[model samples]
Target: MTMLRTMGADRFNYNVFKKKMSKEPLYPTQECSYKMRIEMLDSYLTNQKTVDVSSYFKPGHLVIVDLRDPSTNASLVIALFKIIVGLFVKQRMETGKVLLLDKAHKYLNSDPCSARFTVSMTSLIRQQQHFGIRTIIPTQEPAVVPDAILDLVFFLVLHCFNFPTWMRNLRRHISVNQDRGESEGG
Candidate 1:
């Protein structure tokens, strides 16, 4: 009879070797190594080729909602408004790179009822613009936001000049097209 000896088994030696190798660092411990990895990820995203939004969304698949109601709950109102605007911005960023906000005066004006809501909304819009997001705000109320902020708007719709002074102020930044042909050409 032969005595069983496990001490020199090849399986045991293999396991011991793996355990030793696992304890050794596979990567450098320097902070710069970690930073370089993050930078690579960011560069990948920035350099990604642009794709058509139609590939992701079907034609005529857009939803628009009005959040001008004063009776709606503040939190619910803000959340829904954010969802709509977020979708618009996402689509714009992916495809068009531009968005038009019609009747923006309603939000920019300082109404006694929706002052907080307007302030928060304006802040978000401004932040989005700062990040290379293009927004066209067509509003008759020139006093709502500072002139510098309004200057970012590339297009303006000047119609029915109920306020001549406001029209004049807007004219400084945007050209007024009284003729429909001129507006269409623009």
Candidate 2:
């Protein structure tokens, strides 16, 4: 038997694999697994300088971006998220489900480097819905979030909030919905 190994091959070599394991059948007879695809992109992007992870979402697969790592730069993650959202818009891939935005207020601050592409969460929420992408934004206070976004979100799940201002602001946008629930945190 002859074996051929190529280091860091970009494209797939089905023939080589077939020759090596002639008795074994391919696992994915229909479509490639979504988890495998996410893993592949995660490995590929972590090594690149400027990661454009938007391409992965073109298929509308469920993806979770963990930004809780202290070493990870929040801004870069936000920029990457913007790229994904932009791709979602460009490709018209709308799943019509809440995207579940965490720490969205971080994008409110000004950052000159990503200014051009740093879109508002409000706009993203509005635009995403057109393509059937709903968003769940958890904010400490309505002050941190713009009135526009507050107005745009179809549902609001309120939790224990301290300040009266947050309640005041929320009242303007709050509408009666059975989906609304409480959270342990604001």
Candidate 3:
């Protein structure tokens, strides 16, 4: 409202300076390629009671960003997850921090958005030790897991993985048994 209603008058009551100055704009909205996409983020820019992230991300609070809607886009989830993870790392207590991604196979696929998200997650995984962070990703489909993430993962807590072909694909990314399908984490 202030940006649209900005008015400056002189001592003589003359409203002369009223041009939208590009050199010194009233509002500081930046000029970027993804400006439209950035503005589209509801959690980042909203005035209603819908923005509940800031208050929940406090110490000793288990903030769970669960978008259970099956129709939700992967890119949107990736963006929100990235933002939340970044904030969580910055404000985490000295004790440590944990980032759990349940059913990550949905977004850890071969799509462009998924690839970019995989890169971001792989970077986070590499710096986990330095930032006192631990990431736990539980996926029902191991085939969808990216190679970048598989190479960096320290452990794989598989439950009832009784298929031989599953181990064959799993062995391609990380070391595991060939015949009996055993995953001995490196």
Candidate 4:
């Protein structure tokens, strides 16, 4: 529907299209595109019921939604995490909420998902003090992680990092140049 203008298609003309297709046949590309969309919808949406995603989230316990599928879309994974984060922020808890994006470079990079997640996370990070939330994201490529996040970060943890090459690269990154000079000596 959003692409109707770009597609040069008239809106509210499904019946017109149907009548035309009845006389003619769909072109090869159109046939393949429709078939692929049907298959994709069936694969993801079949047998799925509308349910609360946050019911599994508890106050004092950590719940991990692990996606082991190699072919899963990064946007889908981030979208699920966004829902989880929103739910977590609303829950009353004794312990402070900590969000860990474990090896998040795989799913949070300079892709279509990156821009939207960056905006959402930037807002969340800016309000972390009020919300008592801490976000820890470990990525080998800090470039993949949005600059807004890196700017708001107060602590940077580098574990077992002994490569001068990486250290040199990190020096150019946000805050590593100031106090981590001895790290590359190892």
- What is candidate 2's lDDT per residue for 1-186, written digit by digit as tens? 112123112222333333345454446631244235436555756565444444455454777775454533655555555544555455544345447777766665456533432345666776775667677777775676755666776766666666655655666777533244433122
The worst-scoring run of ten residues by lDDT in candidate 3 lies at: 8-17
TM-score of each: 0.41, 0.52, 0.64, 0.61
The segments of candidate 3 whose C-alpha lies over 4 angstroms from its true place after superposition are 1-55, 177-186
Better of 3 and 4 by TM-score: 3
RMSD of each: 21.3, 13.8, 11.5, 8.8
Q: Which residue window of length 10 is worst by lDDT in model 2?
A: 1-10
For model 1, give the RMSD to the true fold: 21.3
After superposition, the stretches of candidate 4 with alpha carbons farther than 4 Å from their true spots are 1-51, 172-186
lDDT of 1 at 145: 52
Question: By TM-score, how accurate is candidate 2?
Answer: 0.52
Which predicted model would earn the best TM-score?
A: 3
Predicted candidate 4 versus true structure: per-residue lDDT over 6-106, tens digit per residue:
22222222234333544656688867755665465456444445323445557677877674455445665666566557766666677688888787667
Write one digit per residue (lDDT tens) for candidate 1, span 38-133.
365356433435422123333345434555555444444544454445544544333334445666555454565346546545565567655445
lDDT of each: 0.48, 0.53, 0.64, 0.62
- In model 1, the worst 10-residue window by lDDT is 1-10
- In terms of lDDT, the best-performing candidate is 3
lDDT of 3 at 87: 59
Itemize residue pairs with steric clashes in candidate 3.
none
